[model samples]
Target chain A: MLRDFVKNIGYDDPLEICLSELEALLQYNYRISKRSAALLLLQEDPEMFELVRKNEAERAEKIFSIIEKIKPHYSYPLAYIISERRQREASRIAAAVTTVGKKGSLGIKEALSRAMMNPFIGGPILLAVMYYGLYKFVGNFGAGVVVDFLEDKVFDQHLNPVFIDVVNRFVPYPVLRDLIAGDYGILTLGFRYAFAIVLPIVATFFFAFAIIEDSGYLPRLAMLVDQIFKKIGLSGRAVIPLVLGLGCSTMATMVTRTLPTKRERIIATFLLALAIPCSAQMGVILALLESRPLGLIIWLSVIVGVFMIVGFLASKIMPGELPSFYMEIPPLRFPQPSNVLRKTWSRMKWYFLEVLPLFMLASVLIWVGKITGVFGFLVRLLEHPVRWIGLPSESAVAFLFGFFRRDYGAAGLYDLKTQGLLNGNQLVVACVTLTLFLPCIAQLLMNIKERGMRVGVAMSVFILFFSFGTGWLVYVALNLLGLNL
Target chain B: MVQYDKDDKKQVVPLSELKPGEKGQIAYLQAKGKNQMQKLLSIGVIPGMSVLLVQRFPSYVFKLGHTQFAVDKELASSIHVKPVK
Candidate 1:
């Protein structure tokens, strides 16, 4: 039946002649039929070409020469010609077998899909999604309510005291005890930050993200943002990784592989490192600025401004083909609760497992740095820049923590906020700087793995200076403008 | 600028020129690269298929059979289509 189908749906004269000539030359047995192999060879499938070259040896050259001879017979590519012929045959077969029904009226789903993509309505809908999904639920409920309960009630009240007591009683050496349960100890700081702070925020974010993804809104969102993305040297397809960057930049950096061009991937990676904040950090920032809405607004504006300006500059400076956009707009539907929950649970599990070890390692490293006094020296060194940005010297600890994990730094800032060390302006400056700061260690490794060592290190170095430069500029501007909030 | 089919002398326009709700039969693709052509072909945007322009702002979205697709203006402009009355 397959042979008959291939024979019946034959190509034009030139292709048919080339196929036979190539088929006759292909003496080695392939997994697929000789005819199919010939067709793929004619289409210039690179893998097939390599396979045939290896298998058929000298015959492969003859096969390729036949393909070259057939190429000039058409203005379009042989692959396009062959595909078009196949589609025509498929359409004919479909028309013969299928009957058409009268098209139905545009249903409520259709209208809603249209409304979701309409520019006038779409902008507001996007804001609503962000406001509710990101701000209210993830920020307030997850970061605010859950983090408070876990950090204060569970860890601070019950878990930490018990763990500290056990370690102090049993552990004989002061160094080992301090390493396990001291100020920057694995149990007190590392486990506490991961389980109490980062976990809740990440869980809520993944849940909300799963719902949005299942609803089929992301493609529409991509369509709506395609023009803006083009300005940044990316196609709308990039929206996936950029949005995923909100969940976790490390994973998003890995996802940048889906982009077609190297240039787009580079630009996407740079922007993710510099501007996009992961959920844990965003959650903490939201909580920090919840009291001062104006501070939140300023932070939002500065980050967004930096995102656009840097992206535009990158696009202009980097030489490459402009990314073309095309995507299937999946119909909008109500997300299934079970599916959403399962997706959220799996993502949360994956994220937690990946982050826990890193957090603990960061704790151990911090402890070592403290014992060696190197951590204090680094903090003191950072204090100059921290002070230059109009933040108090103590906030240097937060900046140092930021290099380990972006959220860790924001959580540090959150600690300072509780101490009332940060005023309104200082709070916004800290948030912006930390949000644009170097990616965490895991993300740095991922960037190197994905983009190679040189580009990864170069991007990190640029981001380190650029983030502080932007922060310093924001501070100077705020002081110059005399805006109290 | 109006484009005319040299063989039939019929007026054809880039798919981007079609207004929302307007219908057209795909005539040919003026793709500049093989990659662009393959992308359009893979998405079922072949010649002879009927397409309905669904939206024209922010991006050009069109319906082919039961599926809807969104393409930026540049990709949309590569597709030449004959308007259906």
Candidate 2:
């Protein structure tokens, strides 16, 4: 039956010629059928090519030459042409063999799916999702409420004093004490930021993201945003990476590999680096701006405007054909609780493992730098840019922390906010700058790994300058307008 | 809907131009790059496959079998198709 099936399915002329020639050449006993091997060869499937090269070394030359000979015969790619032939044959066989069932009218799920893709309805729905899922849940509840509880009641009240006392008594050397339990210590700062501030916010974000993904709503959301994305030279497919950027920009940077073109990847990377804030930063910013709605609005508008303008300019500057997007829209269904929980757990584990060491390293580096006066020097220099953005010079500390992790910077700003150092406008400026600042160290490394070193360095440098420039612009405009929140 | 070379005078239309509820059989794939072609092929959008326009508001969503695809307008336009009754 399998042999008969293979014999009956015919390919196009060029592919057929190549397939027959490959059948004549390949002598080794492949795991798959000769027909399937031929088809795979015709499609230039790399694994098959490598296998052919290894097994049929002498005959591989003729097979490759046949493929080269057939290349000129097709207007479309060989893969496309061959796949089309297979699809046609498959469809014909399917139609012949199957009977039509009664056509069902569009059901509730279909209607809901369609409503979510409709621009008018979907736009408001998206905003609601962002507000409730992102702002209210992750920002207010997780970051504000939970972080406050963890940092104050749990860590500050109980754990920190205990650790400091124990480390002070056991570790006699000042440098070693500072490294383990002092001002810039690993336990006090690094573990505190990761566990107290970042963990809750990231956990909420992953939970929401998992539910959305499982519900099959992402594709519908992508459809709703496709037009706007086109203007930025990205297709709807980029929604995956962009949404993932909200969870963690470092992971999102790696995910950009799914984009089809180099230009799209570069543009996406730059936007992510410059505009999109990760969950922890987002939660902190949202909490900071919670009492001041105007500041929040301004921050939102500035960041969004930058996102669009930068994307538009980058697309225009980088020469590439407009990205083409096509995504399979799975049927909408209630997200399974088990699936959602499993996904969220796995993501939280992955994220915690990835960030724990980085946070520790950052603390150690800061400790070392502070001892050598390097950190103070850098903060003093960064004070110039901080003041330029209309922020207090003390906020320079946060900017220095930002280089290690965006969340760390936001956490520093949170500390400053608690101390009543930042007013409404300065708070907004700081958030804007931090949001648009260079991505975390991991993301920068990922950008280099994925997009190559030159593009990565260039992107980071461009972001560093552009973020401050935008922050300065916002600050000057706010002051010039004399708008007090 | 299948038009051979003998019926050369008939105008060809892009699949993207089809209205919702309309059906079309794929005719030619005028992809500018291998990436475009490969992506379409990955989802079984190839010449001679029948497609139905499901929605076209925010993006173009088409149905092939029970599988539906949401594609950008420009991407859809590259897929030439013939109207089917």
Please name the candidate that would achieve the greatest DockQ relative to the true structure.
2
Residue clash pairs of candidate 1:
none
DockQ scores of the candidates: 0.58, 0.70
lDDT of 1 by residue, A1-485 (tens): 33434455687677777777888898888888989988888777888999988988777777787888888888777777777788788877777778999869999999989988999999999999999999999999999999999999999999999999999899999999988898788999999999999999999999999999999999999999999999988888999999999989998998999998999999999999999999999999999999999899899999999999999999999998889999999888899999999999998888888999999999999988998999999999999989989999999999999999999999999999999999999998999999999999889999999999999999999988998999999999999999998
lDDT of 1: 0.91
DockQ for candidate 2: 0.70
Q: What is the clash count of model 1? A: 0
Give the lDDT of residue A349 in candidate 1.
Answer: 84
State how far residue A158 of model 1 sits from its true place (Å). Answer: 1.2
Off by more than 4 A, model 1: A1-8, A27-30, B1-5
How well is each residue in A392-439 modelled by candidate 2, as lDDT tens digits? 999999988898999999889989999999999899999999999988
lDDT tens digits, residue span B12-71, model 1:
889999999999988888887878988898899987789999999899999997899999
| Share of native C-alpha contacts between chains A and B (below 8 angstroms) recovered by candidate 1 | 0.86
**Which residue pairs overlap in candidate 2's backbone?**
none
Encode model 2's per-residue lDDT on B21-85: one tens digit a residue: 99988877777776777778888987777899998877889998889999887778888888988
Q: What overall lDDT goes with each candidate model?
A: 0.91, 0.87
